[model samples]
Target: MDYVFTVRRVSKGAFKDEPGSTYFLKVPEDADDISPDQKVGAAGAGMPDKWAKEVLAAARSGENPRTVQPKGDILIYVHGFNTPTTTMLKRHRLIRAGLEREGFEGVVVSFDWPSASSALNYLEDRSDAKQTARLLVDAGISAFAARQTPDCEINLHILAHSMGAYVVREAFDDADDRPAVASTSWSVSQILFVSGDVSASSMSDGNPKSSSLYRHCVRLTNYSNPFDAALSLSNIKRVGVSPRVGRIGLPVNRPDKAVNVDTGAYYERNEDRFRDIPNASHTWYFFDQNFYTDVFQTLRGDVDRNRISTRAGTRSELELHVA
Candidate 1:
C-alpha cells in the first residue's frame, strides 16, 4: 500500500477542484499570478495541517513496540522543481512499490511544493522552492522532532532529487536564519541527494549553508553523475554559479559527513542511456533496481564508504563506483 501524506503548497485558486484526485495545480509563472494553495476548508484555501500531522504520526507509530510496528526505516521524499502536482502523487506510489520490490521495508512521505512545471519558469520556481524550505523544516521536520518522547527510536531517512536538494539545503539555512522555529536536535539518520542541483561548494568546508544540515544528519550520500544534462544547464542558466554537486560531486573536505557516489562509470559502461533527451543516467536511481539495493545498504550506515566500491579521484574528492 502507498502510505503517502501529501502537503499541497500551491494556493486554492491555483488548483483545480477535482473530486477523486486531491491535488491539481496551475503552474506559477509569475509570483503575482497564482493564489497561495492551502487546506481543504481553509480561508482562501490555506495549507493543511493534517498531512504534516499525519506524517509525524506515521513516523511516531513506527517506533511503537506496543502497537503494530514496521521493521524498517521511515522516508521523507522531497521532489525537484518543475514537477506537476498530479505527477508527484504518481511518483510517491511508484517509489513505495519500487522500494518494496528491491527488498526495502519502509514507508514514504512526499512533501509537494508548488512547482511551475515549466522549464522556462526556472527563476520563478527557484524563488518558490527556496521559500518553501521553511515550511518543510517547520511543519515536517520540527513537528516530527517535537513528537518524539524519551524512548522513541524511529529512524528517519531523507531522499531528495534534483532541485529538491536546493530545498533541503535552504531549509537548514532557514533554520540558521530563524532559530526560533528550527529544531536543532532533530537529527536525520541518513540523507540521499540524487542528482542535486545545488552549488558544489555549498556543502564544502567553511560553507555555513551546510553547517546546520551536516550537523543535523548522521550521514549524507550524494549520488552524482558528470553526465547529468539537467544540472549542466543549471550551471549556465543561474548567475554566479559554481560547479553543481550533482554534476561533479560533493567536496572532498567533508568526506566524513557526505560521500559522493559517482555513478558516471555506470553510464559510460551502459551505452543505452541516450534513449531520452535528458539521458537515462540521470534517472537511473529510479529505473535500476540494484541502485535501490545500494540505497538500502546506505541506510544501514555501517558499511565503510571505501569498502562499498572502488574509490576514484583524489583524496580531496572520493567517488564510489557501485554496480
Candidate 2:
C-alpha cells in the first residue's frame, strides 16, 4: 500500500483544486480492482498524529523481515504545479516502484496540496502553492518530528520537484515563525530538488529567503537539466522571475552543504528514448532507471557525493553520467 496525506478538498468523490483540512489515506496498488463503495474512509481528527506513529513504527521495523538494516527512512515527495491528485498519486507509485526495483526498503509518502491542474494556471497554482505551504509544515513535517524519538535510527527526507521546491522553501519559512518545538526544531537528512522552480539567486549562500531551508537540512542536491523547456528563459509562465536553479545550476555562492548535479549531458544522450514524453527534460528523471539508482544511493546516506557511480566530476561540479 502507498501512503498519501492530502490537503486538497474532495468534490463529488474526487479531489478538487482547493485547499481543505489535512487527511491521511492508505491506497493499495491494486486499488483499481476495488469498487468505489469498497474504498475506505479518510482518517479522522488527530489522524496526522496517528499516521505519524504508524509511519515511524514501520520505518523503525525493516520492511523485509530477513534484512537487518539498522535504519529505514521515509521520503516525503512533493510534486510540482499543474498536477491533479490522480497524477500526484501516480508519480508517488512510480517513485516507489523505481526505488523498490533498486532494492530500497523504506516507505514513500506524498504531501498533496491543491494545484490547479491546468497548464494555463501557473500563476494561480503558484498562489495556491504559497497558501498551502503551511499545511505541509503543520501536518506533515511537524507531525513526524513530534513523534521521532531522541535515539531514533530512522531518517526523514524530502524530494521536491519543480514548483514543489517553491512550496518546500515557503514551508520551512512558515515553520520558522512557529513557536512550537516540533515546527522550529525539525530537520531532515537529504533534501533533493529535481527540476526546481525557485529562483537561483534566492538560494545562494547568504540569501535570507532560504535561510531556514539551509539551516534545517543536512544536505541539498539539485538536479538541473539545461534542456528543460518548461523552465527555460522563454517560458512565459516565469515572465519576470530570474533563472531557475532547475534549468541553470545553483548560483556560485551556494551554501556549503548544497551540491549541484547537471543532468543535461545524460539527458541529451538519452533524449531519443524520451521523445514521446511530454516535457521530457523536466519530467524524465522519475522514468529513468539510472536516475533512480542515483536517488537510491543518495537516500542511503552512506556514499560520499563524489563517489556515487552514476555521476562523474568533482563534488563541486558533478555531471550525471550516461547509463
Candidate 3:
C-alpha cells in the first residue's frame, strides 16, 4: 500500500499575503503522485475547488522533492488550548525543523484540533477536543501499523502540550477500551505530557482493571510546573485543584502509577515572567532553545542529559519539556 504525504500552510491570525503557519502530512508518500485537486475537483468527487487547490499546493511543496524514503521514528504532536489551525501547523513545522537541525530522523505529524481565538472558546474547545484527538490518533496508528515493514522498527510517540495532554489522555483511554484497537501488535512507546492540566483524580478514578491508560501505552510522563499561570487559572475556573503535574500537595515520592517530572526549578526561575497572557508560560517548553534542547534529549531517551534537581524530591526534569 502506498501513502500520500502533504504539507499545509494555515493562518492562525489574520489571513494576509504571507501565511503564518505550516504543517506536514505523512500519507503513503506516494500520495504526491495523485493530484488531490483532480480527484476533489472532478464533478463526481464532490469536494470544493478551493479546498482541492489548497491541498494540492500543500502536497507539492511540503518536503524536499528529492527525499525518497520516509524519515526516522514517527512522532505525532497535538497542540493545546487557544491554538488556531495555522498556529498548530507552524508550531509543528518549527519543532520538525528544529529536530532536523539537531540531526534527528522521523516523520513528525501535527494533529490539529479546532481552537477558536476567544478565551472562552478555547476553554470550551479544550473540554471538547478529546473526541477529535482520539480520531486523529486512531487514524495515525492504524495507518502506520498497516504499512509498517518487518525489517524496520516503527516507534510511535505522542507529545501533547498543556490542554493537548487532555486530548492524548482521553484518546489513549478510549483506545484501551476497544479491544480490537488496544490489542494491536504495534506499540506506543511513550506518551509525553507537557504541562498537562489533567487532574490526578481523573487519572486515578477507575479501577486499574478498567483503566485504558496503563494498559495501552508503555510509558506516561507528566512534566509540570506549579507556577504555570494558565494552568493555575484553569484549576480555579474548572477543576478546583491545581493541574496534575504541578500540584503542591502531592506525595513527595513518585506515584507508582505514572512518571512525573518535577519542574520546580524551571518554574521558580521563570514564574514572574510567565504570568502574562501573551507570554504563555507553557509554550516556553517548545519555543525556548535551551528548553527545547532538554526536550530533545528526553525524546532521544537520554533523560540524564538534562536533569534538574528540584525540591519535589529530585524528580527527573526532562520529562516536562515535550516538543
What's the candidate order when arranged by decreasing lDDT?
A: 2, 1, 3
Ranking by TM-score: 2, 1, 3
User: In candidate 3, what are the lDDT values of residues 56-121, reduced to their tens digit?
Assistant: 233232233345433235667877777764566566766766766765566566665555555556
Q: Model 3 residue 174 lDDT?
A: 77
lDDT of each: 0.66, 0.83, 0.53
- Residue pairs with colliding backbones in model 1 are 10-37, 11-36, 11-37, 12-37, 38-46, 38-47, 39-46
**Judged by TM-score, which candidate is best?**
2
lDDT per residue for candidate 1 within 185-221, as digits (tens), equals 6767898999898988888866888887887888888
- List candidate 2 segments past 4 Å from native: 32-46, 61-70, 181-184
Q: Model 3: which ten-residue window has the lowest total lDDT? A: 1-10
Candidate 2 local lDDT, 1-323, one digit each (tens): 76777777766766678887666776777863212222234433534555566677666635333444456789999999988777787788889989989888788988888887688999888998999898787777767876766456678899999999999999988788777743356789899999999999999997888988989899999999999999987887778888999999899889889999999999999999999987788899878999999998999867899988899999778999953
All candidates: TM-score: 0.78, 0.92, 0.67
lDDT comparison, 1 vs 2, better candidate:
2
Candidate achieving the largest lDDT: 2
CA lDDT, candidate 3, residue 200: 55
